[model samples]
Structure formats: C-alpha cells, structure tokens
Target: MAPHDLIEVKNLTVSYEEAKLPVLDGLNLSLSKGETTLLLGPSGSGKSTLMYSLNGLYPEELDGKLTGERFYRERPYEAFNPGELSRRIGVVFQDPESQFCMLTVEDEVAFGLENLDTPPDVIAAKVDWALELVGLSDVKEATITALSGGMKQKLALACILAMDPELIILDEPTSLLDPHSRQAFVETVISLQQEKGFGLLIIEHNLDEWLAYVDRCLLMNRNGKLFYDGSLAQGFREHYETIQREGIWVPRLFRTAYQLMERGIIDDRKEFPMELEAISPHITHGFFTKKVSYSSGIPHLSLENVTYKHIIHPLTSTIHKGEWVAIVGANGAGKTTLSLLLAGLKAPSGGTVTLNGNRLKEYRSESLWQEVGYVFQNPEHQFVVDTVFEEVAFGLRLQDLPETEVKERTETMLEHYGLAAHKDRHPYTLSQGQKRRLSIATMMVENQGLLVLDEPTFGQDEHSAQEIITLLQQRQQEGATLVMVTHDMELVDQHADRVLVMENGTLAFDGSPEELWKKGKRWLAHHQLQQPFRVRLEQAQKKGAAAIESARA
Candidate 1:
C-alpha cells in the first residue's frame, strides 16, 4: 500500500447482471490526498460505474458482479462494509431524487451522522455546517418534495458534505440542476476543495465549468479504460486532437485559441487560456471572425401577454420558429412550468397560448403532438413501451399509422440518432445517455413544427450531445422550431439562435446570444448563467489590451 495514495484501483473489472460484456475492463486508477481529478468519457464508458465501484455501491446495491483489486485507504474491497465505505468516501449521485433517504433536508443531511452514532448535538452542528457550506441554510427545514430540482441537488451534496469524508466522489452532480443551482453547487465544491484540500474525484461531461478549478484530468475510453491521466494543461495539449475527435467539449477559449493558431492569426506559441476571463481580450481583438444571423420568419409560437401560475407565481414568454431559445434560471423559476404551458401539455392557469394563430385548447392532445413535440427531462417518466423500437414508435402507433410506415420511421430515427444498434434492447437496460437519446429520438419521429425539449442533453456525453444538437438543427432547417429549457450555457452559445433569460417566473431577457453576453456581468451572474468560454476569452483580451496601454503610458 502506498502511503500517499488514498485510493488504489488495479485491474478492476465490473459488469451488471445478465450482461455478458464487462462495462469496465482491467481499469487502473489512483488518487492521492488533496488532489482533485476530473473524469471524462463518453456514455456507457463506465464512468458512473467506476464512481459507484469506488464508493462501494457495486455488487451490493447495484446487483453487479465485481472482480479485481479495489483498495480504499489501504483496505481491501471485500473487507469494508457499506457503512465503512460511506464514512471514508462520500458519494453524490447524478439524480438527487435517487439518493434521498429522509423526508426533510435537515434529516437527510443528518442520516449519515446518525448511522455513525454521533451525538445528537454533534450531528445537529454538522448538519448546520453542511447546509451552510452548500448555501442551503435557508432551506434547512424544507421538505424534499418542496425543494426544486436544483435545491434537491444542493441538499444531496450537503448530506454528503456533512459526513466530512476524506474523499468526495460526484457522479454528474450538475446534470439535473438548473443554471443557477449548477453554478452555486460547482462553486461550493471548488471552495471546499481549496479550503479543506480533500481528495475529489468527479465524473462529469461539463468540463468547461470545472477546467480552471480541476488539478488533473483523466480520460477514459468506451470500455472504462484509462486513456490518459496527468495535469490539466498536459492533458489538453497532448490529447487536443484526440479529445476533439471524441466530441468532448474542451474549454471554449481553448478551442478559439487553437483555431487562431491554425489560421495563422496568432504567432505566439503559448498555451491556451484556461480561465474564461483571461481570453476575453483576444476575442475582442477579432482573432477569429464569424457572424450568426437569424432567419426572418414569423413567430411559430406566440404568447401575447400570456401569463400562467403554479398556485401563486406567474410566468410569461413568447417564441418564434427556427429559433433555438434556451429558458434558463434558478430552480423554482417556472422554467419547466412555462415549457409545459407552451407545449400545451398543461393548460395555462391563465392567459392564452397560441400556435399558428390558433388557441392551444382548441387542439386535441393528439393533434398537438404533431404540431409540437415535448420531451420531458426525465426520460423514464415518459417511457411507456418495454422495448426501444416500441418506445420510439409509440406515437406513430397512437396515430394509427401503418405498421410499415411506423417501422420505417422508427428505424430511420434510431439509425440517425446512433441508437440503431440498441433498437431491440429494453429501455430500462439502456444507460442514462442512451435513454436520453431514445427519448429525443422518439420525439423526433414526429414531424412537428415546434419542438419543446426540456433538458434534452441531460446525462449525455459530448458526442451524444452533439448528435442530438445536430438532429435538432436538421429539424430547424426543415422549418421546425426549437424551444429548449436547459441550464447549459455552452449549449446555448453553440446552438441557440436567441436566449430567453427567466428570473422569478418572468421573462427577463430575450435576445441574441452575443447580445446576452453584452448585457453586463451582473445579469449573467444573477441568473447563475455563464457566458461561453469563447466570450470570456474575448473579455480577457480586452483586459490585456488595457494592461498593455497602461504599461506604454
């Protein structure tokens, strides 16, 4: 056992029940004390499984067969029980709802301490500290049901943080959160790592948010094998081409800087800027040039003075065709509710929702399905069929389409979206990313003019996300409209035609992505939204220019 290594995994292999192929194969990884490692890989790459194995959830709660060596703090894998593993390595799952054990937030945070038989007073103090650390002190007594998705996620983090584990493993912690909550949660984790110097291992696809904060980056292949492991700088430089080929989202500024280097726009051989603010000036100086323009089309969906309420607060907004608009804000900001009303899934508590100049209520649910397709955030919640083909063909079946047409459309969608190989697989057996793709593919089968996608890219890898985005863009090119309710600002910058900023249930800003970036930092910060890394690099360049001017003066 190495004294410096907190976790030593060698020749590790894991597979689920009834599956012949191992998800993770002969994998090796090591984590040292006070080091933060970012884990990156595509969906079904065993990143989540690796995290589960590290936290002792495999073979116990997961019903999987495990093999090979897994040593935690010098203890063998079989030697430690769930309680013992929980004490040393605290885990925060991707979905907060899955982790909740207690009804109230405070009680949930106290469960681990109580299990350890800590004194009541000590447990209470720790709970309070954890809540404060995650910025959830105000909601200490809130019920789990009362908290929004972001609040629930934050509460889950607090529950683990209260235990004060030596190593914290987060498996896609920000995937389900809103923009504001995701920002706050990431900041909280980074602050804790800097202040306490704990061993942090994170499996996440949103690398742009954590690149500056991470100490090291680990790349894994499809089979849960380590491809590269080293400092963040070295990983970015040495694996730049390979990483891009894998469709991973490198820092936006890095991509921009790399483009400049390729075009002979910049002669400097320096490395790309890691931080967003550091690269802003170069972008402002016009290192690269591209203009994005929106088509001149009539509004496909309009809500004129439209107002809706969920018991108390009201939400108002409008959208146009061929518009990739993102609805972003903190949790409980009515983003989901607004999406429902717009999609005609739920009738507005008040006001009118018009599609093609006709009231939504006049259209039957069946008819609305052809005009506007809505994909819920949780794919499992909307799934009705047992098999993937049936799931995607369900709507066509409902429409009484011929079996041949149904099969044709379903197979085409599956093939286009990279799910053709899994067309016969059970929906439950699919990975999180696979399920998300299936759900979106199901909606894509319908040639709707307006598509309402709620967190469409949630739980997806860079490759899956790009595939989904390209599908949406194809729809838009075919005269379909897109309204995406998401927390991912990078997705917005890369794909959106316009941005809709929501705060406290009202539309705060509706404009172009670049215009949103120009609207002052306070606006972005208030909504917990971040500018794209490329935009931040531009700002950094402007600052650098100012510094140079001062030096010349």
Candidate 2:
C-alpha cells in the first residue's frame, strides 16, 4: 500500500451462494485519504458488494465467501480487531433504515459510541457535534421513522461521523431525495468531508450533480471488473462511447454537446464543456430550446374534490388518454397518496374519482384490476411467486391465456427488461434494480390501459432506466395513459406531457412542463423542487452569450 492509501484491495472477489457467479471478481483498487471519488457502473455490477468488502461486511456480516487480500491503512483486514476496522472505515448504505438500530435520532447516533464503551460525557458531545454537522441538531429528539428520506440519510451520516472514520463510503445516498434536497445533501456531505478531512467514495447512477464536484472517477463494468480509474475529465472525454454503451449516465451537458456536434450543428473543434458555467460561451442561440408538443385526448381518469384524510386535501384533475403525467414532490408530500387515489387502490375519505364518467366505487375489484394496473413503490410488495419467470407469468396465467402464448409473452418481457439471465432465480433474490424491473414487467405484460407507477425507475441504472422508460413510452404511444410518481426531474422534463406538483397534501402547481419551468427557480425552490438540467443549461447558455456580446461591444 502507498503511504497515503486509506484502503487497498488486491485481487479481491466475493461470492454468494444464491448467485450463479461471483458478485465481484479479482478487483484491485485503492482509495487515498481525503480524495473524493465517484464509483459508476450498471445495476448489479458489484458496486455495493465492493463497498461491503471495503468495510469488512462481505463474508463477515453476509453469508458470502471472500478470497483475496484487503488492507486498511497498510494493515491487512484480518490483522485488525473486528470492530476496530469498521471504526476506521465507515459506510452509509443506500437504505438508511438498514443500518439504524435505535428508535430516536439522538439514540441512533450514540449507539455506536456507547458500544465502544466511550464515556457518557464524550458520547453526548460527539452526538451533538455529529448531528450539527449534518444539520440534524434541531431534530435530535424526533423519532427516526418521522424523518424524511433526506433526513434519514443525514442521520446515517451523523452516525458514521460520530465514529470518526478515516474514510466514508456512501452508496447512492441521495437517490431517494428530491432535486433540491438531493443537492443540499450533497453539499452538506462535501462540506463535512472537507472539514473533517476524510476520504469520500460515493456510488451513484445520476451524475448530473456530482460530476462538477467529484475529484476522481472509478468505473466498473458488468463483469465486475474495474475498467477506468482516473480523473473525471479524462475518463469521461476519452472513453465516452464505452461509458454510454454500458448504460452509465453521461453528464447532461456532455450528452447535449456531443449530440449537437454529431449533427454538425456545433463545431467539434472546441473543447467540450463539462460544467454548466463553461457551456454558455460555446452556446448558440436556440441551441438548448425546449419544444413542447403534446396531444390531449378524451378524459381517461378524473378526480373531483378528492379528499384522502389529511394526506391529500380536496383536489380535482382530469387525465386524458395517451397523456403522460408526472407526480413530483419532496418526500412525505403526498405524491404516493395521490397516485393511490388515482389507481383506485385507496378509497378517498370524501369526494369522488371516476373512470370514463363512471364512479370508481362502481367498478368491481376484478374489473378495476384489469383497467388500472398499479406498481407499488416497494417492488417486493407485489411479488406473488418464487422465480422471476413465474412472477411475470402469474398475471398472464390468471387471464386464462393459451399456455403457448403465455410462455412466449412472458419470455419476451423477461428478455426486454434484462432479467432473462435471472429468470430461474427467485424474485426476492434479485438486485434492487432487477426487482423493480420485474415488478414493472409484470404489470406491463398485461398491457393495462391506465398504469400508475410509484418511482418506476427507483433503483434502475442508466441503461435499465432507459429501457423501462422506453417500454412505458411505447405503451403510452399505443394509447395507454401513464401516471408516474418520481423525483427524477430530468425524466419529467423529457417525458411527461403534464406535471403535477404536490406539496403539503395539496396541489401546488398543475400545468405543462413549459409552464412549470416558467414559474422561475424561486417559486419551484419554495416547493422543494429545482429546474431540470436542460432548463438550467439553457438559462446558463443565454447568460454566457449575453455577457460575451456585451464585452465585445
């Protein structure tokens, strides 16, 4: 290991019994102290497994086999005492609930310290310092269950900080947060890392926010091998095609600039812009113009004065056939509750929901299930069978379709969603991303006219997310109306014909994407939302061009 190396792995591999192959294979890597590195790869590419290995969770906490050497600060993992390794290398998992043990925020942060037999007075001071660092000091007395997704992640970080680790591994920490909240959380983490002087390694699929700030890029492939390990600028620019082909998300600015160059609309001779601020001077008039075009058809679903306890207040809206509507808000903002009411899964406390001018209450359970298909936010909630193939085929079999037809359709759905390789595996055994895809495929296989999906692309990687959205788009083009609840503003901007802004159990804004963008950043920020990347790029480009023209005059 090098003098500054915080963690090092030499030919490490992790294997689970349930999996057909090793999750990670002979990977050699190193992380330097105080360096901020971004880990990028497709879903199920062993990103999480690698993190587990780094923190001594793999083969120790899990029923897995590890064969290779891993070192922390020049000491082999086996050389150090059990709990001592974790204190030196802390981890913040994707699901914060998994790592938490105590019920209240204060108790949770101090749990690790108390276990270490630290003095009560020291624990108290550490708890206060950690919570304040993550900006959760005000909510120290609150229950863990009461916090939002962003708050939960912050609490998780606080727990890690109290341990005073030399390095922190964050596994998609902000994927569940809203656009504005996600940015805030990233900024807080970066600031804390700088102040504490700890090594930071974050795994994320969405690169829009982190590309501008991250120092190093560590990319893995489907084979669980590290392919590129270097600076972000060189890795992205030099290997753009491989990155895109693997379904890894290219920063939005790079994608747009590359496409324009390909079309001969922009000169390819100039250096491509990586950050939003640098893109404006290279921008041409109308280069990033957003052209909105959507057709409104007959009303497919309507909610009139809909009331769902205090979760959703009296609301009225009409969703037209073939139109895609996106429901977006901060966590606990009633986006899921409103979607439930729309799908006829949850009966409202008062008011009415109608389908084709017919009251929702009038439809039989079987009849309603056929017309309105709902995908739960938790993918595991909807699984009814063991194997992936059986799960997808379960609904088709209920329809009494011909065996041969069901077999063909089921096979096709599995292949399209990238689950064909895991067809025989149990649904629960699949990766989070793969499970989400299977849940969606089961509903889409039935070809329901109206689909209600909550965070449809929740755990999907760049490639898988695009495949799922493409399939949904195809269904919408074939006359199916889509109502999706998502925090991905880019998806909403590029796909949804209409946008529904939910805030504090009420409709804050109901309009087209263009109108929503026109509401200005301040109004959007007030609701805990931010403008999409494309819109930000367009604004920056205009400002940059204006400044250049003024300077020339």
Candidate 3:
C-alpha cells in the first residue's frame, strides 16, 4: 500500500454457503486519506455486505466467506487483533436506533473511550470535543429518549468521533433524515473530514446532497461486480446509461441538466452545477404541474382539533375519499404521532378523530383495521408473522376469506412487490428495502378504504420506489385515500394532490404544493426545506426578473 492510501482491497470475493455464486465478485478498490468516496449501487447489490467487511465484522463476526487481500494502513486486514479494529475504525449504522447503547448523549460518546481504557478526564474531554464538533454540546446531558431522530444520528456520530478513528464508514446515514437534518448531518461530516483529515466511505441512495463533496465514485453493477471507479463527475457522466438501467440513483439536478442539453436549452460545453454555489446561473422557469380534484362526498377520515397528549398540538385535517395526501416536516415535528392518531393505532388524547362520520372509539378494533390499513415508519414494527408469505397473508386470513382466494391474493401481492422468491424466508432476514415492500404488500392485499403509511419508500431503490408509487396511485384511482408521511419532497411533488406541512407539533401550512410553494424559496427554507430543482429554478427566474425591473426603475 502507498503511504497516502488508507485502505486497499484486491480480488475480494464474498460468498455464502448456500449460494452457487459470490455476492461480491473479485472487487478491487482503494481509499485515499482525507477524501470522501461515494459507493453507488442498486439495493441488494452487496453494498451493505461490502461495508460489513470493511470494519472487520465479516467472515468471523458476520456470515460470509471472505477471500481476498485487504490492507488497513499498510497492515494486512487479518493481522489486526480481534476487537482492536474498533480503535482504528468507526462505523455509523443505517438505523441510528441500533447504534445507541447509552442513556445520555455524554455517556454515549464516552462509552467507547472507557472501553479503550482512556483516563476519565481524557474521556470527558474527548466527549465534549466530539459533541461540540457535531454542534450538540448544548445537549450533552440530554436523555437519548428526548432527542429527535436527527439528534440521535448526531449522537451516534459523536460516539464514533470520540473513538478518533482514521477511517469512518456510514451506511445510508441520511435515509431516515428530513431534508434540513440531512443537510446538517452531511455538512458536519464534511467539516470534520476537512478538519481532522479522516477518510470517508459512505453508502447512500440519495446523491443530490453529496454531489459536491464526493471526490471519488464507485458504482457496483447489478451482478455485484465493481463496474466503475473514477472521478465523481466523469464516472457519472460516462455511466449515466448503465446507472439508469441498473436502478442506481443519479442526482435530479444532473438529470435536469441533461434534459436541458438534449432540448438545446443549454449549451453542451457549459459546466453543470456540481455544487449549490454554482446552481443559480443554470436556473430556468420550467415547472411540472398536476391538478387533482376530490370526488363529491364526505371525507373518509377527519381529525377535528386532534391532539395526542403532549406529543402533538391540536391540529385539524380531513382526507376525502380517493385523495392522496403527503405530510412533510423536520424530524420530531409530530408527523408520526399524527399518523398514529389518523390510523386509529393510538387513541387521541384530546379532541376528536372520526372515520366515516363515526368516532374512532366507536368502531370495533377488528372492523376498524379491515377498513383502514397502516404501514409504519419502521417496517419491523408491523412484522408479527414468521415468514414473508405469512406476513402478507395475515390480513386476508383475518377476514376469513376462502383459503384458495387467500393463497391467490397473497402470491399475487408477493409477486407484485418482488418478494415471491423470499416468500418462505423469515421477514426479519430480508434487506431493509425488502422489508419495506413486505410492509406495504401486507396492507395492500386487502382493499381498504383508507391507508396511512409512514415513509412508504424508505429503503427502496429507484425502480422499487416507482413500483410502490404506482401501487399507491392505483389504489387512489380505485377510490382509496392515502396519507403518507415522508421526507422525500420529489415524491410529494409527483404523487400527492395536497401537502400538509407541520412544524413544532402544529399544522403550519396545508394546501396544494403549487400554492404553498408560490411564496418562494425563502419560505420553504424557513420551514427547513429546499424546493425541488425545478421549483428553485422558477424562483430564481422570478428573482432575476425583479432585480432587473428594479434596476431599470
């Protein structure tokens, strides 16, 4: 290994005992010091499997046969003593909940230091420095239970940073974060990398935020082969077609610029904006619009001055039959609490919640679920059945449907969600994306009048996300109401007819996306949101016009 190279892998192949082929095939890669590398691949492309191997958790700790030479800091990977890698390497898991092992932020950060036998004074100082680095010093004594989703993620990072690792591996860190929180987390990581000079290996599905910071890009083919490794821009530009075909995520801005180049709206020689600072010159006023009209009738579900004890403030909303609604907000903005109340999973602590003109309390639990389907924010929360097929079939069997009909519908739903092959496998054994599909499929088997889903497309790939959206659209057309809680603004723009923007446990804005967005970019920013590129481009055009007109006057 070169002096500058932090880690290197050559001819790595990972295989399971039951499978004929390897999951990762003859991969070769390297990471340089103080640089951020983005790993791109479709779901089930062995990204997580590769990540597992990096932090010394593979072959011995986790299941898999590892064959290939790997070096960490000029030393063979196998040469490291067991558990000693924890001092040299740090990992922030995809689910922040799984990474926490302490009750307070300070303790969480100090846990690793104590494990390494650092002096108490040194541990305390390191904890303070790590929390301060992540801008969470003020919350050092805060309880883990009180921290928001974003705060928990920061705490997780603080704990890792306290260890002072040379290399940091993050697995889809932004998958569960809201727009503003995601920006904060990524910016913090970037700042620390520049400050401390540690190498970064990130596995993320969303690329829009990381475009500017990524120094190198690695693309894995659908067959688990290392397809491309090069400079970020050229790799994206060269592999655009393959990326699209393999369901790999490309930034929306990149696609937007590509479309404009195709239409001759922009010169091909002009550089596209890789960073936020360069986006203004490329802005245009084209906007995608859609109109949605509700059918004439009473709302299928209504929350009249609904309040969930201290968790949610009194907020009123209504969902008309067949109308698809989306809820977006910062993390801990009462979205999940509101979803629970609407779905009848939790009784409102104040005010009234009604469905079909009857109070939620009046409906029988069995009948209420039959008419209302709920998909949780955490897919694991809903899994009670042992296997994937049994999980989906649970709802059908509840209504006492014919066994023949139940089998037919269950199999069809499984096939539709691309889980037919894993039907016999335990639901817990599936990937995060696959688990999300099972959650949706189970609810979809029965034709419920109302469905409330929290982050429906959480871990899905581009294609799987589209498939899930298509399923929801079909249900909407068939006269079902959809209330989705999401941080994905692009999804809201394309699918939701109306958007409910919540801030601080209360309804801040509720209207059509176009109407709410008309107040412009600053307005969205105040709500901890950045508009989609098209919306921002339109806003930029308007701002440019106003500046020119004022100058003439």
Candidate 4:
C-alpha cells in the first residue's frame, strides 16, 4: 500500500459457504484520495461482495469467509464502528426507494446526522449544506413520495452527503433514472467530487455515459478476479475482444465504432472511439436509423375512465393482444399504480378494467394471477423462498405438474437466466442484478399471458440484459402481451411496439416510438423523458441532409 492510499486490500479472498469456489480469489486493490474508479464485473462475480467488504460488512454480516487484511488509512478495517464508518465510507444502492425510510427530503438527509448524535445546530447546518450541494435545497421540505425516481435518487445522495464521507460508493445508482436525470447526476457527482476532493468508487452496469467522468477502470473476470487495473482508455482498448465474453457492458459508442470498422462501413480508423461525440462524426448518417412498426389488434385489456385514488385521473387506454407496450411517465405520474390496477391488485375508484371483454375483478385469484403477472420494482419484495432454484420452482410447483417435469423446467429457467451456479444460494444473498433475474424468471416460468414488468433490466449487465430481452421477445412471440414501465427510452424504442405515456395524471400520448420522436423536445420535456440517443442522432442527421439539399437547390 502507498503512503497516500486512502484504502488498500492485500491478498483478499471471499467465498460463500454454499459455493464450491471463491467469488474473489487472492485479490489486491487500492484507491487514492480524489480518484474516481469504475468497477466492472459479471452479475454474480463478487462485485457486491467486494463493496460490502469495503464498508466492513463481510463474514461478520454475511455468509462468507475472508482472509488477509484491509486497511483504511493504515488502520484496521474493523476498528471503526457503524457510526464511524458512516462518516468515512458512504454507499448509495441501486434502488433509491429501498434506502429511503423518511417522509421528506430534509428529514431523510438529517436522519443520518441525527443518528451520529450530531448537535442540533450542526445537523441542521449539514443537512442544509448537503441538500444545497445536490441542488435539492428548494425541495428539501418536499414529500419524498412526490419526488420523481431521479429526484428520489438525488435525495439519497443528499442523505449520503450530509455526513461528509471521504469515499462515496455508488452501486448501480443510475439504473432507474431517466437519461436526463442520469446525465445530471453524473455531472453533479463529478463536480462535487472535484470541488470537495473525495474518492469515488462506482459499480455500474450502464457504462457509456459514466465514461465521461470516470478517471480509472477496474476490470474483473467472470470469476471476480481482477484482470486489469489501469487508466480507463487503456483498459478499454486492451480488452476490447474479451469484454463482451466476460459479461461487461461495453460503451455503445465503442461497440458501434468497432462494428463499423470491422464491417468496412467506416474506413481508415486506426483505433476505436470511446465517446459518442467522437464516434458520431465518423459514422454514416443513416446507419442506426430504423423505425418501429405499430399496429392495432383486438383489445386484450381496456381501461375506461379508470381512477386510482385521485392519483390517476380518469385515464383510459387499451392494451392489444401480443403487443409490447411501454408505460412511461415521471415519478409519481401513476405508471406503477395504473399497472397495479391493470393487474387487479388494486380496485379502481371510478371505472372498469376489462380483460377479454370481461371485468378483471370478476375472475378468481388463481385464474387472475395466471392471466395477469406483475413483477415488482424491487425484486426482493417478491422473493418468498430461500434459495435461487426454489424461488423459481415455487411457481412451477404451484400448478402441481410432475416432479421431474418441474425440476427440468426449473433447472432450465435457472440456467437460462444465469442462476444455475447459485441454485443453492439464498435469494437475499444474490447481487441486485441476480435477484432481478430470479424475480422475472419466477414470474415467467408459468407463461402468464399479461406480463407487467417495472424496470425489468435494472442492475443487469449488458449481456444479462440482452438475455432477458431475448426472453421477453420469446414471450412476445408466444402471444403473451407485455406492459413495461420504464424510464429507459432505449428499451422502449427497441422493444415497445406501442407507447402509453402518462403525463399530469392523464394519457398524454399514445403511439409508436417514431411518433414520440416527432412530438418535439418541449413536449417530451413536459412529460419528463429524454429522446433516446439513436432518435436524437437520427434527427440531427436528417437536419444536416435537409441543409445540404437546400444548398444544392
């Protein structure tokens, strides 16, 4: 360890009891003050294990055995208590909603300081300062329930900032945030880290946007072994071939440039472009320009003037059979609630939801769940079993099929979703991404007709995300209709055949992704969604072509 190192680990190994091999094996790592590092690893490759160990929660809090030493400023890692650790190393989780236990932003931010027995004056001052630094001072008193998903995450950051930790460990912080909100957050965190001079360690699956701010990169193998630790650009360039195989999310810009170069679409390129701006100039204008088709079928489910406890104001829409529909809205805009109503989880205060021309409430519980499946925003909420295998098998077994058939189907789904290796592991012990896969697999095992998923790809690496998407595509082909509530415009553009947009508690727009693009910037902003990158790029290319045409004329 260097004298200037903020944290250092020497010859660390972490292995869960149920597993045959170590998740992390003889790994050594170090971080310096004011340095920002992005840690990349496969979904269950002990990335979360390393982060948990950093904050002194390891074999002590989880079922794992650790060897060797970890040092914080040359001190023993376990020397500090929980309160002391909170003041030194802070963490923000993937789901901000899970971390929040308070009503208002001010109260939540101050909750941490108050627990440390900070004086009233100091707590008040720190809370105010933290909120101001995160640009949430005006909404400090705002109710947490009313904040958008992005705003909730910002509040989570403010809560962490209030304690003034030297190192902020963010685990998939932007997975649930919209593009604009995510961009704003990355900028804010970087600016604050630069201004305040602190160390940053971010574990993210969404890799492209973060490239602009991350200074260093730590690449982990499929087995969680540290393969490369160096400058971001050097690591990206060195491991270009093996990254996808290791389940890493290669930056879209880099991937596109590499594909173009390999296929002779773009000539005279000696090296890959890692940034979007750099790659845009080299690509042909219409390379990624493709339109999604939207066609109407018989209405499988219809909502007529549905109202959900004053949150969704007399909203009406129809979901067609075999349709991939995306429900997009800002936080608190009734996306989840409306989905719940559609699933028959909650009764509408003012209208009827009809499925197959019959009222949804008229069906039996068993029949209803088989017809309308809902996956929650937080995967852990739906977990009922202890082990990964049983969690998925529980649904299959409920229908009382043959035991061998159940086992075969369960194992097949497990392997399909990359949970076969950890079949015996506890559900709660899995990484966020692993848990999400389990949840979706559990719901899909029965082949429910209507699949309502919220942030289905949250916490997933690019490879795993693609696999899940493939599964969804399979479901679509099987005549199962899917309704997805997501802030990821890219997912909507790629998967959704139709989009149902809720704005200000009403159905503001209903059409295809192409239509959403033509809705203009201000209209999208009014609904709190950024156009997908490909959509924006296509628009820019069209404008450039139009300008050239005018000049030629």
For each candidate in turn, the TM-score is 0.92, 0.93, 0.93, 0.92
2 versus 4: better lDDT goes to: 2
Clashes of each: 13, 0, 0, 0
TM-score, prediction 1: 0.92
User: In model 3, what are the clashing residue pairs, if there are any?
Assistant: none
lDDT of 3 by residue, 429-510 (tens): 7878889999999999998999999999887888788889889888888889999998888888777878899898899999
lDDT of 4 by residue, 318-413 (tens): 899889999997766778888889889889999999998999989999889878888888898899988998999898787889999999999999
For residues 1-553, write the lDDT of model 2, one tens digit per residue.
8899998999998888877798898999999989999999888889988998898876678676899998888888988777777888899987787899989999999999998899999999999999998778889999998786667888998899899889999998887788887888888888878888999999987677786678999988888888999888778777788888888877788887777777776676665667687655555666555634344579999999999987889999999988899999877788988998999989999999999789999999888888999998778889998899999999889889999999999999999999998999999888778889999999999999999999898877888999999898888878899999988988899889999999988999899888999999899888878899877877887788788899999
RMSD of 4: 2.7
lDDT winner, 1 or 3? 3
lDDT of candidate 1 over 3-22, digit per residue (tens): 98899999999987756688
Which prediction has the highest lDDT against the true structure? 2
